[model samples]
Target chain A: MDASLLTIQPASPEPIYRQIVEQLRRLIAGGQLGAGDLLPSVRDVAAFHAINPMTVSRAYGMAESEGLLERLRGKGMAVAATVRPTQTQTQRLALLEPQLQALVRHARELELPADAVLRRLGRLLED
Target chain B: MNAMLKDAADRPGPPLAARDLGHGYEGATVLRGIDLDIAAGSVLGLIGRNGAGKSTLLRALLGLLEPTTGETRVFGKPALAMDDGIRQRIAYVPQQPEALAWLTVAQMFDYLGRFYPRWNHAFARDTLARWQLPANKLFGKLSPGERQRVELVRALASEPELLVLDEPAAALDPVARRELLREIALRACEAGITVVFSTHIVSDLERVASDIAFLHQGRLLLHCPVDDTKERYARLWLPARLGPHAPASTLGRRSHADGSVSVVIERDAHGRWPDEAAQPGVRLDVLGLEDLFVEIAE
Candidate 1:
């Protein structure tokens, strides 16, 4: 992996390590990463993103514990071979659920109608 | 084994510890009573407003300056009496580089390298070349940014166990700042080096610092893990009608013209909000690190 594609918002209230864990989960579920794909080393990811390595290692550890990744001796982490990513379509949608809920909340706060929100969402999806 | 590494792990106490540390100059106090312990393998970000005595605290902590009250310990030994072995294990970079203005960059490095047996000359040479700093140019002739980078290079080349940097990226561009952060992270992760750096850049602190120390008016107000600030603190707004219900232990209490009260509140030990937070018409807003700083600092 280039590792550069994995980015984090330091200013976000969420912990940096949790951000990495969630991003990796999404990538794996979306098929950007698959079984047997080599993940970047903690050192490389930390150096590339200017983040603490412990944070990266913690993210990898969480993914490993959840069966998304497995450690190879002296080779760092890799996508777990046994991961069939069950319910991937739902998993991918689940990733966007928070943002979608946020958008609907904002629309409701603005007193926008449901049809207007659906039209806007449809336009954005088409784009 | 390196004495620094041995001292870090074998010692029963923190690598750097201060007890009621206070300092003054000409009857004017700079640091108030302070008690702190910097654990091994932790990156502590020291943050404060201007004239908050951050430098004085660091100087006192490292034994560069004698405190008017209390004491500091380095590796469980009195900081004021560190021997050559202890001295060799620590590296400090002051905010401004003025100690070796008379020597060229290369000469300065060469002179300093003699004092540190394990100095990595290759790192100094490669970093200087990569940073586009002239090896033969007088240290005084370099721009502030270049000077700071040279100091950083010198500090890292020493491979010390305890690295103290005072605003290490104050003069650098954004790109240089990022590069410096990466280097700091790499050192802490690979070598398990304990680091204490004071920085005005909160975002950089958020990214790499494991712990944060907030100094306000020479007093240490908050010292906690970086992530805790977000999940543990919030702003609670009380309507004027419920003004009497505001928590008394809150911080940064303010009364707006609308006759409402806003105060900074923290989760209890059991992770529950205050009783007033459950009242109707009360609003609670979670605070980010920067917002938390502003709320309390302002």
Candidate 2:
């Protein structure tokens, strides 16, 4: 996995640690981070993001608790070999839910028809 | 005093704390009623405008300066009379760290390392090499930024439980600043080092600080988690006529000649803005630390 895939928005209201957790979840579910792929050390991410290492540790801890990551002694964190097979499809698509919600909300706010919004999404997927 | 010591032994508290700490110079008050409790394993960023008493507060906390009122305690012992064991556990990097100009960097390290029980010479050597600081050069020959890095190396090598830094980044360039922050984070994460660093660079604070304390007019105007501060305080733009209806908690305000007003107000603890901010003409914008500082300082 590209360590650079993890990024943070300092201005956003979301806590830094949650951002790390959410982004790592997306990368893992999206297949960008495959099973057993090594996640960057907390020190590296915290240094790159200029955030508290505790925040990065918290994110890693949350992912570990959720079974998305596994800790290997002396090897740092890695994507778990298996994560939620029962909800595999749901979990993969769930990664896009927030962006989709925002798109739908924006379309509704602009008074666009639901069909029109769906058509645009279809076109986007095709692209 | 014996009773207090026994009580401290019974129930250990925060690594550092101060209660109603106040100090003055020549009868003119500089710090007043300052209160702080530094949690173990957390990074706290202290920020304020020039001469806002940040230095004084740090000095008082370290027991370097006697408070005219109230008191400061380190590991529950009176700060002023901290035993050598307690003193050894704490390290300080002053705003303008001074060194013996005649001594080579290696000699200086050797001198300081003698005093620290847990000093790691290898760590100090590695950091110097990483920063590309010349160990052979006399301390006086190094630039201000290099000097600062040396101080950092010395401080970090000690493995102190509590590290106090006053404007540690003032002399650092951007790259060096980032390196310093990374070292601080690594220490806090691995060793649970308790850090209290004051800086004018809000961006650095935004990055590493778990919590931020804003000193204004000789008092702590705000102290809270960085995330909470970001979520709760915002700048709102509205027509000048609506200014009177601004939230009662408006921290600062500025009137534009265009008949619009910009006001900084904090949302309630529930993270809800005042109804006035939700009115049709009001436009609320999230503020980064720098913007927030400007608004609050003004």
Candidate 3:
């Protein structure tokens, strides 16, 4: 899996580590990541994100705890076989609802109608 | 989270742990009873005032300086006695970007690249091009910021698990600093490399750092998540007519109960203020990492 698939939101109250875990979880559940796919080494991820390795470790630890990944001895971490797709999707959507609501609210505040918003959304989906 | 903890629990030993670390030079104590732990693949930020002994602590960790007392361990091995194999997994970038004066950028990189087994040539070349750094420029002739970038490129190209950078952005201009940080961020994301860099620039730390450790008067003042610090720490601006008495619970640099004043405080999210404290003349503002540093260090 491409390590750049991870995204962090610093402005949100959620810590970067948690954000990393959540994003990875979403990708794994969405089939963007496959079981046994090797994740980037901790140093690479930390350096790429310009964050401390401890933060990445925490996120990785969280994912491992959730059975979404496994840290193989000598080898780096990989997606776990036991990840639950439906459960993860539900969790991700629940986590995303507030942000989606805020985006829709702001769109409405900007006087964008439902049809215009849906059209833009459709265009985005098509892309 | 459970699986991670289980894995961590099942692991036979600690990754990096320091205990009661103390250091001094010629009877002048620099750091005392310093204790820290860094799991593999985690980044840790070390922050402090000018004389707070941050460099000393780093040197102690690197075994460049002998700690007067206590123990330092990396991956459960004694830090001082680490073998070349262990050392190969770690990299250090000092505060001053130092290199052989006569070596050109490419020559310098070529020379250092020989020592590291995991040196990424393609990445180095890409970084050189992306940063617009001239490969032919003499090390000594380059500007301070350029020199710093060279040091960063050298460190990043090595692909070490633990990279310790000492104020890599100090000499960089605003744009260069941002670009350098962005590059570092990108690399970290790609490699899962652990990083610990020291910097006085709080906003830069805020931009990328996940964990922050504040050192003051030769000791660690606080170590916590950046967000937690921002949420719990605040600076309260109060008027002079409030009287000579300062708020008893707050940690502040200065207080003027008799005049307009600003007080820094660490309070719970739902904290309440005294009736007198809530007067019309008072204002409250959250303290950024810099403000918190000043308050704690002072």
Winning candidate number (TM-score): 1
Local accuracy of candidate 3 as per-residue lDDT tens digits, A38-70:
999876776655555656777899889878899
* lDDT (10s digit) by residue, model 2, range B124-240: 999899878999999998888788888888888988889999898877777878888888887777777789999987778877988899998789888888877777888887777
Clashing pairs in 2: none
lDDT of each: 0.86, 0.82, 0.73
Expressed as tens digits, the lDDT of each residue in B10-87 for candidate 3 is: 544355677999988888989989888866555567899888998887878777777899988865778889888767
TM-score of each: 0.88, 0.81, 0.63
Task: Judging by lDDT, tell me the better candidate of 1 and 3.
Answer: 1
lDDT of 2 by residue, A26-127 (tens): 776666777888889887887677679877888899999988999988998998988533446767787778678767555643557889888888998899
How many backbone collisions does model 1 have? 0
Q: Please give me the DockQ of candidate 1 compared with the native complex.
A: 0.44
Task: Give the per-residue Cα lDDT of candidate 1 at B42.
Answer: 87
Candidate closest to the true structure, highest DockQ: 1
- Ranked by DockQ from best down, the candidates are 1, 2, 3
**Between prediction 1 and prediction 3, which has the larger DockQ?**
1
Measured against the true two-chain complex, the DockQ scores of the candidates, in the order shown, are: 0.44, 0.34, 0.12
For model 1, residues B40-64, the per-residue Cα lDDT tens digits are 8889999888899999899999999
Chain A TM-score, cand. 1: 0.71
The most accurate candidate by lDDT is 1
**How are the candidates ranked when ordered by TM-score, highest leading?**
1, 2, 3
